[model samples]
Target: MNIDEKRFTASTEIQKPVPTKRGKSTTTWFALYGFLFISLALFVYVTNVLLGPLRLLLFDPPLFLRINELAIWYSGIPLVIGTALISWDLFRNVTRIRDAKFVRNDPPANRFLTVALTAYNDERSIGGAVKDFRAHPLVKRVIVISNNSRDRTMEIAEQAGAIVFNETRQGYGACVHRALREALKFEDTELTLLCEGDLTFRAADIEKFLAYIPHADVVNGSRIVEQLQERDTQLSLYMHYGNLFAGKVLEMKHLGAVSLTDVGTTYKLCRNVTLRELMPLLDPRINLEFNAYFLDTALSAGVRIIECPVAFYPRVGTSKGGNVNNRIATRLGLRMLWGIFVDWKGFFHD
Candidate 1:
């Protein structure tokens, strides 16, 4: 071959692109749409099955045929169309769920604080919990309230070198009230996080909880259920069931998110000034053992409750609170249930 012909051949080889069989976009779309169509069909069936009975209940005219036809047959098409559109949007949103990740810093946004932890009989795991808080670069100071422990909880906590406070309060709620009462007296603290002695949080998550507080007076970390690996004993499940019930009630009342259930948590971050003022209003009779729905009761007094689902670890130590005959959790659950009405204010925030 001539040099020109060889050059042209080499150029042709270089310029040729590799063949790639694009997977059938047509088949994928068909499958997705087909699933949606089947879902719509199921939606139509279920809506008719459920609403048909309701028509009889409402239609006191005793008109069986008219109500039966009107209830299901008259509305089937719209129900199917509505379900398909909504399911499509919902499935689209499911794609974005995994986008969430742990964020240690809250950009230029979060108001940082010296996270204050209070402990009583936490000899087993206070160190790890405090270490978890101190691990975050945002943590400036950790004040541990080693209140009247029967064991070496104070020694382990003090050895941890946190500014430890030893108090003689008979109740966890009382200890917290006393601890915060003393802490607020100093006036040096900007923000104080009141974490449960046992609860575990992810790194830098306190910042996420704090980011919403200036906008919301009380910013609470909520579990969005993307990850809730913490399995608790009866105490934990009782708390879980209470929380689920409270969440539904709040939704019904249009009340914004409040951790009405898991209120024993060690992760309460509060404005020192605001908390000090509110502490006096708290029912001193309550303790962490059987009570603390006072946090929910605070909502009735117009305290803003913003939920931020902080990551949770199952209880390293659980108690016999939820045993078969222990009316304790039931009573507390009743308090939470009753408090929804007794201490509830119509939702003031979105």
Candidate 2:
């Protein structure tokens, strides 16, 4: 189908109203109260750990004692308020189905999908990654978007038969945004598979994504499965639990809408039409915390998302993303929380 025809069909399908009896007020109140309590607990714990030593060393005894006493007493006020609000919401609200879009048996018209891989200084793995996806029977084409890589990533990707483009804006979000935009230009494929060129994820998972895509607009790959993850991969035990915690926070924000377990995953499949509708709502400036931001924005916009477990392997090259170290991962996790609680636009540095 032509782009205009596809646009019309997508718009028509999206405009169809799904009936739901759930009230928005209750969900919003529940999320707000839960977040307030969790944020207060985290804030208290983090401050005490980070500032307790400094307060003892710098402040006089009287001042430190007063501050400690006040923190101890005043913190309970929010705790009580949050508990009451949540309790009220739970007792007042009745559980109802939020989504009427039941299990969809409607598969894509075309089985072939356009594969887009994000590359940044991945010369060691770009070629192999491109070839692996290109060899997939269902993959119509492979496209690679290099994020200003100073290496031969672009050259190797082209040599491996992938259509290559460079995203001058240097960030994972920018590269992923460019890939989706480019993938949408293809009329032969109805689906777009977004992944990284670091070889951590393989083309073999495309079947898993395809199986789940028929049920939702997007199929996000989850690396939380212990059997699927390789023992020597970059996903340490700390990062694994951290991703799960962040994913739960996001799930709570969109209560009863979606269940998420891995927000840090980069491998996902999106329908071209869904991407066309969702592109404008995404912000590429969110940096390392972009995946969570993407999922959050998609859920908030009423886009359906489902998770599929995919295998995780060791990286062939150096890791430049958030998984590089525990310190960077912690920073990224906090940034994700900040975006989730406050605002995403506040995360833009430039």
- Candidate No. with top lDDT: 2
Per residue, candidate 1 scores C-alpha lDDT tens digits across 1-350 of 99999987765552322221222111122223333444456665676677666766876345754665565564556556645654554465443323321112222233556666666677777777777777777677667787787777777776776677777756666676666665665555556666656545554577677666654456655543445545643335545655565554443332222333344444666766557557767654455422234455445444545566677765544432333334676655555555444442221111
- lDDT digits (tens) for residues 231-286 of candidate 2: 79999999999999888888767666678999999999998888998999898887
Score every model by TM-score: 0.57, 0.82
User: lDDT of each structure?
Assistant: 0.54, 0.84
Spell out the clash pairs found in candidate 1. 195-266, 196-266, 220-308, 221-308, 221-309, 222-308, 222-309, 223-309, 230-314, 300-343
Q: What TM-score number comes out for model 1? A: 0.57
- Cand. 1 Cα-lDDT: 0.54
Q: Look at candidate 1 and tell me the lDDT of residue 91.
A: 61
User: What is the number of backbone collisions in each predicted candidate, taken in the order shown?
Assistant: 10, 0
